[model samples]
Target chain A: MKLYLGVAKDIVVKRTIDRRDQKRVLGNLYDYDVVIKYEIENFKDQPVILDLAESMRALRSEIGVNNQRDVEWELVADSTLTDKLDEKKSTADQAVFHVSLPLRGKDDKAVKQTHTIHLRIKNEW
Target chain B: MKLNGILTLTLALLATMPTAAKNVDLSTIPPRDTVQLTIYNSEDLTLVRETRTVTFKKGVNPLQFSWANTLIDPSSVDLRFKTHAGELELLDTTFPHDKPQMLYWAVRSEMDGDAELEVTYFTSGISWSADYVCISDPAEELMSFDGFVRITNNSGEDYADAQVRMVVGTINLVEKVRELAQRGLVSRDEAKDYERSRRKAGAFKADAKNELLSKLRADFAMAENAARQPKKIVKEGLSEYFIFSVEGTETMKNGWSKRMRLFQGHNVPFRIQYRYRPQEYGEQLVRMFLLRNDTVSRLGSTPLPDGVVRLYRDNGRDGLSFSIEQQIKYVPIGQEIELNLGRDPEVIHEWVSIRSWRNAFWFRRHGASVYYAPGKGHRIKINDAVVGWDEHQAWVERIRNYRDKPIDLQIRRSFDGHVVFRSNLEPSLNDYRSPQLTAQVEAGEKKELRYELVFHQGHNQKQTNVTLESVN
Candidate 1:
């Protein structure tokens, strides 16, 4: 049994509407990290962030395993890998499309089931 | 002398040969050293001054042209030609108004074919135009751009002490706009620009500085009067949009009372750029205003310097957006640049006002008619005898599902002349902005009874005794 995945397709980070940068609230929700390269087996079980997925359930950050451990990852529900009905958004010449998960795997017969497939992708502007 | 006087002089020489071919150059006032480009001896023109445009084709042109010593004092000048490949190299006996002059050429070409061209110079009057005016309200985060640039120097050439800067981009980003449209320097070809960016004394620096309009003005005036206008601010780019306001999503800034006329420009020489999406706590305040007055005189070609204008911010609803690329600095040559820019102090309120009520029925501005008429039928009767309104703030609510709702009412009838009635008023009042609907009309003088209108008509016949509460 073997599997793996890697990604870093298109990356855009241009801004001009700021609300006091560094922010993070809990219950009322307000957490913004823009884009950084942390890793936790590439977002545990990927596919979250559908325009923030109805106010969010879970999608923590701070990853760095092989480069020497720096964990603090969290992902609640993995979404089989996006395209839950295709449709991209374009606003006044700017662009956006996001997704990312660095690896994948699936196996059955070790007495039954063993699956762990991850993913990652991003298209921003 | 007799063939009908030669057919009336051949129809007057065929209408004077098309009025002399449409009055070729008509009055002829352009000539200060007219006829400038003469590249006969010095072949291969590489770069001719006067800004640009002097390219030769054909294998080995190598030209160096100049006439009457070449301005500044070339014994005035005079030269002309329609087509010349004979390459004379130079010619201009003498002709000069002498104040404004520009004659240059540093020829160098490895020619290929049509290596011939001629130009007659003389400028005492040359002014062209396109001007400019872009006014979009998108509900006013504010953008009412304006334009106009006119400079006619007659070619006698008198540029005293010059300093002009007007290049907003496009056409490859503004190239001195074809030398201000060739000395005539007129603007308005819909903000002309195919690609142009010139810097001699240089005036363009933006790595990401800051300044759209520090202070610059030639003449500015807003609000033609829709009750004084100026309230149309509905923005939605809060990073995702929602700058200036967002409580439930700020929205007002509508039509400023609908007087709609603004966006004006005259004589020409203007610059107006506006953008708003502030109300930021972190960072997002883009502001710029320079309505010109020119400050010290020469008036409007280009002069407004004060400095500081940097724009670029993005938040695209958290994934984080940032791309600030706006620049405008040093604008005080003549003077006029207003600034209120973005605002992110949390903003108490950005703007909001939405009241809906347009044409209420029951008309009569000059009453006394029986059923509205000068012609007789179309049924009309508005005595307005029982006008009401004094003490009643009503609201008949109840409608989560009354089963039907599609009402239409444009009532006015004494007989059947203009009456419209569609059923389904069923929505009693689901939170009607706080109950405020009163109706009561009693002519006996209780006075404040409000209003009431009752009319009946039927063409159904047979047992026609229908009064189901007057059809709701």
Candidate 2:
């Protein structure tokens, strides 16, 4: 039996905010907050264990178009839902991440930049 | 001594007869009257339907069906009454606890008589594949094509006098039939629950079952009708499935294979061309024989299945010379089939880089600053660092055809990274990254193709794709 999570329809990029003004700000580092909402469901008869950390590793974020700027992002340790799902049950959860865009120049503007986030679900046996 | 011999004979007869134990009367299954096999090549699955006459007593009659050493999925086993549907009822089917590969069905009969029962199940290890042979005449303009299908049976059971059909499309299977066949047997309650869930989810469609049975019946009728004629394959299209039903019955023994002719086309006309796709066929020119799977080519009766095609040429001296053997995918009606005969030594293709130079230099005032931005003009500074430039490259391609006949040739070249392609051959963009050139060379002629490319480097590069420009 396989679990169908409907990843395409269940995942949404909630919001992206420029968090450079937050406390503990660094001079050379640009920070942004990206929130995502997702739902995982087990529609089969067998129970499946979903490794949240492993799944979070597959999340990708890119800033700008054509010539893209390098950005690093990771799950914020907290705000992770359960790692396992029971049969015939669904869980709606939110994941928050901090994207660090390195400042290439003083005039570099990272705000309101066209960005894309891709999420893929990988099965772990 | 006569009385002793009679007693021994009676004992032997009693031992051979079916015995009733614990109110369950065990009866051996009778020989099949007619059997049909529908084999799907994409998957190791065959749907088998066979009929047999079984004598059932009034009340509950236990019939034993065993699939010992056979790759028959026990979960897919089904029993239906073909002759006395209204008079017989299947109470329940039970897999014996001690027996690993055996099952019993408790059938209730309204009246005691002989009734024909149909047993249908899915099995693995029986498969069919298709191949073709093409023989070209001395002129190479016309050819004869013949298709054949080879069916191999390794299912641990022999199917005698069975009609065979091959499906040319893929079907979705959640689980492999081989795995299920080796899964032993699940508990009756669990099996029922699984079946109920599957039905509720509509995973098992009733229409599909009906279609299968209808196709089998039609094939059986066609087989009977074509009994007197020479062996032929009748083609039918059922939704997305294309079936080739082999006429007449075949006795397929275990671990045996049989090849049957599918179709033959005589004097099918075709054309030949030479292609040079550097990205696909490496750096060599390949000869191709082209034909369409339509009536003009004498083959449009049905879609051609995927197969290996062997090409031979008639040497005009009462002998045939082998040319090439290529594998082709399934071709629908009216679709062209292109057979690649590999590199031809008679045609020589040479690609040479004539010259390369760098020009259009741009200088930057400050280090790591923009040197040449698009839509911006820059002046040369005395001590400025060189930060960008454009590189020019020229290439010459030559093709020499030594054949007696004129040859048609096509060449494709791919480039990347802000490239401007200028060629006198009037090349066109096959895609954003590749330029294509076509030419017709006369007999014993050599053609030269010249093209120049300019690649933008550093800040001069604005795009990452090739730009095609024609030059006289």
* Each candidate's clash count: 127, 0
Residue A37 lDDT in candidate 2: 43
In order, what DockQ does each candidate have? 0.01, 0.01
lDDT values for all models: 0.23, 0.66
TM-score of chain A of each: 0.17, 0.31
Runs in model 1 deviating more than 4 A are A1-125, B1-302, B305-324, B327-334, B338-345, B348-360, B364-472
Chain B, candidate 1: TM? 0.19
> For candidate 2, what's the TM-score of chain A, rounded to 2 decimals?
0.31
Candidate 2 per-residue lDDT, tens place, B322-406, comes to 9999888999989999988899988888876544545565656655565642224554444455556677776777888889999
B215, model 2: CA deviation in Å? 10
lDDT per residue (tens digit) for residues A1-125 in model 2: 48886664222233432222211112111234443443433332333333322222222222221112111233343333322222112111123233322322334332222233232221110
lDDT of 1 by residue, A1-125 (tens): 34544543322222221111233221111223323222122222333332212101122222111211111122213432233312223221112234442332343111111122122211100
Error of 2 at B40 (Å): 0.3
Tell me the tens digit of each residue's lDDT in model 1 across B366-398: 354332222223332333221211111111111
